[model samples]
Target chain A: MLDMIIDFFVIGAKIGLILLPLILAVAYTTYAERKIIGYMQMRLGPNRVGPKGWLQPIADVIKLLMKEVVVPSGSNKALFLLAPILFIAPSFAAWAVIPFDVELALANSDVGLLYILAMTSIAVYGVIIAGWASNSKYALLGSLRSASQIISYEIAMGFALVGVLMASGSMNLGEIVKAQDGGLLHWFWIPLLPLLVIYWVSGVAETNRAPFDLPEGESEIVAGFHVEYAGISFALFFLAEYANMILISVLTTLFFFGGWLNPFQGIPFVEEVTGWIPGIAWLLLKAGFFLFLMIWLRATFPRYRYDQIMRLGWKVFIPVTVVWLMILTFMIKAGVGPWFTGRGVL
Target chain B: MTVESVVFYLFATLTLVGAIGVITMRNAVQAVLCLVLTFFSAAVLWMLLEAEFLAVTLVLVYVGAVMVLFLFVVMMLDVDYASLKAGYTKYLPLGIITALALFGGIYWVIRSEVFGVEQMPEPAKHGADYSNVTELGRLLYTDYFFAFEVAGVILLVAIVAAISLTFRGRRDRRGQSVPMQHQASKEERLRVVSMESGPRQDGQEKTEKKKRIRRKKGGGS
Candidate 1:
C-alpha cells in the first residue's frame, strides 16, 4: 500500500512536470505564431501586451476563462460539455511517449512511436463528438470534413512512419534517435527525404492547418467544427490544435531530423563544439525549426480547395508513401544502406 | 485486496457495464457509444494482461477508426425508438435459443481438459524494455508466416471487393484540371466577336400579337 502511494506520488509529479512545460509550450506557441505571422504580413503582433506580446497567451487565457460558455438550446448537453475536455486530454496524454531528453519521458514504453500515433488517432473523436453535440448543420458538416480528412491523411502518415521504423529497426522513440547518433548522414531523412516531406504534409493535414484547413475555413464554414464553441470550450480546441502541431513537430525531429543530435556529428571540430550544448537543446532546436516551418507554410500557402487537398492526400501522398514503404523494406532486408547498422546489416 | 486485483476488478466491471449498455441503450447513437466504451474497456483489460501493444492497437483500430465510422453511420440513420423495440418480442425465443447454444459452446470449450490452465500458463513479467511489438512481429514472420500471408491476402481481397462494389466513374460529369485552370488566360473564357448590332426581329412580335388576337376572339365566343 505504501509502495502504491509512492507510485501515485511519483506519477503525479512526473505528469505535473510534463504538463507545466507543455501548457507553457502550448501557450507560447500561439504567441510565436502571431508574432511570426505578423512579421510575415509586415505588422507588429500584440506588442501592447507584456513586452512584445510575450504575455499575450496568459491574457487570452484569462479573457477566455471570464467568458460564458453558452450551450445551444438544442445541443446534446452532456456530450457538448465533454467535448473540450476530451479534445485536450489526449493532446497532453501523448506527451508521455515523447523523450524530451535521454531519460525524460514519463512512460518510456516499448511501443512509444505507436503510442503517439494511437493517441493522435483518437483525438478526432472529440472533434466528431463536439460537432455532433452542437446540433448545428455547419458544425456537423465541418466535423465530418475534418474527421474524414484526418483519417485519410493518417494512412499516408502511417506509411511514412514505416520508413522510420525500417531505418531504426525499433518502434521505441529513444532507440530511433539513438540509431541516428553518428551524424547528419546517419539520420533517416537522408534516404527517406520523400517520406519526411510526406510526413510533414500529413502532419499539416492531421492538425487541419492552412492549405489543408478547408474544414475550418473561416470564410466558408465560419471556423468549422468549433464554430458553436465559446469561452474555455473554444480555447480548448485551439490549444489541442497547437499541441498536436507541436507533437507533430517533435515526432518529425525524432524520426527524420535526428532528435537531440548535433547536425554535424561526423565533422570532428563541429561535433565537439555543438556537443557541448545539452541534448535537450538540439531536440528543441529541431522541433522549433519544424514548428516555425508550420507557421511559415500557413502564412505562405493559400488554403487548398477541398477536393484538391483530398486528391493530394489520396492520389499523391498515399501512393508515394506505400511504394516508398516497400522500397524501404527491401532496402532494410538487403542491407544495402550504411544507416542499416542497428539490425539486418553485415 | 491487492492493488493489481483491485485494478483488474475495476476494469472488469467497466467492460461488463459497457457491454450491457451496448444492448440496453434505447438510442442507436447511445448504443454505438456504449460499444466504443466496451471496446476501450476491453483494451484496458488487455493492458492488465501485460499486452500493452495489443491494448493500444485495439484502442487505436477499433475505438478510433472503426467506431468513428460506426458512429457516423449510426448518426445518419433515422431510427424510430418504437420501431426498434418492435422486433424484440417477435425474436425473443429464437434469440434466446441461439444465445444459449453459443454460451454452451463457449462453456464446453472452457471446461474441456484439452484447454486447461496447464496448456497456457500466465506470462512471466518482462523487463522495462521487452518490446511486445518486436516479439509479435518475429512470431508472425517466422512461425506463423503462412497464416499471416493468408490473412493479408484476405484483407486485400476485401479491399478490392469493397472498391469494386462502390466505385463508379461517371465520365458524363465534368471535373476540373488544375493545370488547365491555371494555364487558362482571359482569351479562353472571353471571346471577342465584333459584329454590327441588328434591329430586333419583328417575326416573334407579330406571332405574339396574332396569338393574343386569337385568344381575345376565343374569349369573346
Candidate 2:
C-alpha cells in the first residue's frame, strides 16, 4: 500500500513536470503568434509589459484570472461550466503518450496514436456543449459549423495517418519514430509528403485555425460558440485552443518530421558535432518550427469562406488522401522503398 | 474488494447513473449528454477488459463522431417538453409493463444455470508486451475477412443511399463554383474599356447636375 501511494505521487510529479512546461509553452505560443503577426503587419505587439513583451502572457493570465465569470441567465449552468473543462481536458490527456525521449513517455501504450486521435475527436463535444448550453443562436450556429467541419477533416486526417501506419507498420508512436532512424531522408515526410500536407492542413481545420476559422467567423457570428463565456471560462477556451495548436505541431513533428530523432543522424561530421544536443531539444525545435509555420499561415492567407472550407476538406483533401492511400497500398505490396520494404501485411 | 473490483464497481455505478440520467432528464440536450456519458462509461468497462482497441474505437467513432452529430441535431430541434410529458400518465401502465418485462428477461438470463460465473470463467491476464491489436487484426483479416468486407460494402451502400436521398444538383440555385472563381482573371472581372482621354460628355454632366440637385434637396430636408 505504501509503495503504491509513493508510486502514485511519483506519477503525479512526472505529469506535473510535463504539463507545467507544456502550459508555459502554450502561453508563449500566444506571445509568439502576436509578435509574428505584428511583424508581418509592420507593427509592435504587446511590448509594454516587460522586455520584448516577455511578461505579456503572465499579465494577460493575471487579468483574466481577476475578472468575474459572468454566466448568462438563460444558459444551462451545469453544462456551461462543464464545457471549458471538457474542451481543455483532452488536450492535456493526449500529452501522456507523446514520447519526448526514448523512454520519457507517461504511458507508452501500443495505441498511442489512436489514443491521441480519440482525444482530439472528443474535443468537438466541448464546442457543441458550449454553444448549446449558452442558449444563443449564433453560438449554436458556430458550434454546428465547427462540429461538421471537424468531423469532415477528421476523416481526411485518419486517412492521412493510415499512410503513416502503412509506412511504419506500427501504431506505437515510439516505434514509428524509431522506424525513421537513419537520417532525414528516412523520415516519413519524404515518402508520405502528400499525407503530411493533408494531415497538417486537416489539423489546422480540426483546430478551427485560420484560414479555416469559419466557425468563429468573427464578422458573421461575432466570436461564435464562446461568445457568452467570460473571464476564466473564456480563458480556458483560449488555453485549450493554444494547447491544441501546440499539440498539433508536436503531432506533426512526431508523425512526419521524426520525433526526437536527430535530423543529421547519418551525416558524417555534422552528426558527430550535433549529436551532443539531447533528443528532447531536437523535438522541441522541430515542434517550434511547425508552430511558426502555423502562425505564418495565419499571417499569409485570408480566412477561408464557410463553403470553401467545407469543399477543401471534403472534395480536395479527402480525395488527395484517398488516392495517396491507394498508391501507398501498392507500394507496400510491391516492397518498393526503404519505408515499405520490410513491413508485414498491414 | 480488490483494486480491480473497486475500479469495476466505480465505472459500473457510473454507467448505471448515466443510463438512468438518459431516461430521466427533462431537457433533450441533457438526455443526449447522459447517453454520451453512458457510452463513455461502457467504453471504460471495455478498457478494463483489456479490449483497448475496441474501447478507444468506441470513443473515437461513436462517442466522438456519432454523438456529436446527435447533439447537433438535438440542439437544433425546438422540442416542447410539456407536450411530450402530457402523454406520460396516459401511457404509464404500458411503460411499466414493458420496463418490468425487460427487467425480468435480463434477470432470467443472468440467473439461469447455463449463464453463471462458473460457466464462463474470467479470462487470463496478458503480459505488458502482449498487444491485443495485433491479435485482433489477425483474426479480423483471416477469420472475419469476408464479414469485414461485407460490412464495408454495406456502409458504402448506406453512404450512397444517404447522398442520393439528400443531394440535389439544382442548376438554377447559383452556388459558387470555387474552381471557376479560382480561374477568374483580372481581365474577366475588370473591363478596361479603352477610349480617348477626353472631357466629360453631355450625359455625364447631366448626371452630375442631377446628383447635385438631389444632394441639395436632401440637405434642405
- The best candidate by TM-score is 2
Instruction: Give the per-residue lDDT digits (tens) of candidate 2, residues A1-346.
Output: 6665677689899999989998999889999999999999999988999998999999999999999998888889999999999999999999999999898899898888898999999999999999988989888889888989999999999999988887888899999999888889889998899999999999999998999888898999999999999999999999999999999999999999999999998899999999899999999999999999999999999988888888988899989998998988887787766766675354
Clashing pairs in 2: none
lDDT of 1 by residue, A1-346 (tens): 8887787788899999988887899999999999999999999888888887778999999999999999999998888988888788888899998888887778887788878888888898888888889999889889999999999998899889988987887888988998888888888898798999999999999999997897798888888899899999999999999989998999999999899888888897887777778888888999999999999999999999888888899999999988888888777767765677435543
Total colliding residue pairs, candidate 1:
0
| For model 2 chain B, the run of ten residues with the poorest summed lDDT | B1-10
Candidate 2 residue runs with Cα over 4 Å from true position = A344-346, B1-6, B166-172, B193-221
lDDT winner: 2
The DockQ for candidate 1, computed on C-alphas, is: 0.43
Local accuracy by lDDT, each model: 0.87, 0.90
Error of 2 at A161 (Å): 0.6
- For all candidates, the clash counts are 0, 0
Candidate 1, B50: how far from true, in Å? 2.1
Locate the minimum summed-lDDT window of 10 residues in model 1 chain B. Answer: B196-205
DockQ of each: 0.43, 0.62
Per-model TM-score of chain B = 0.76, 0.80
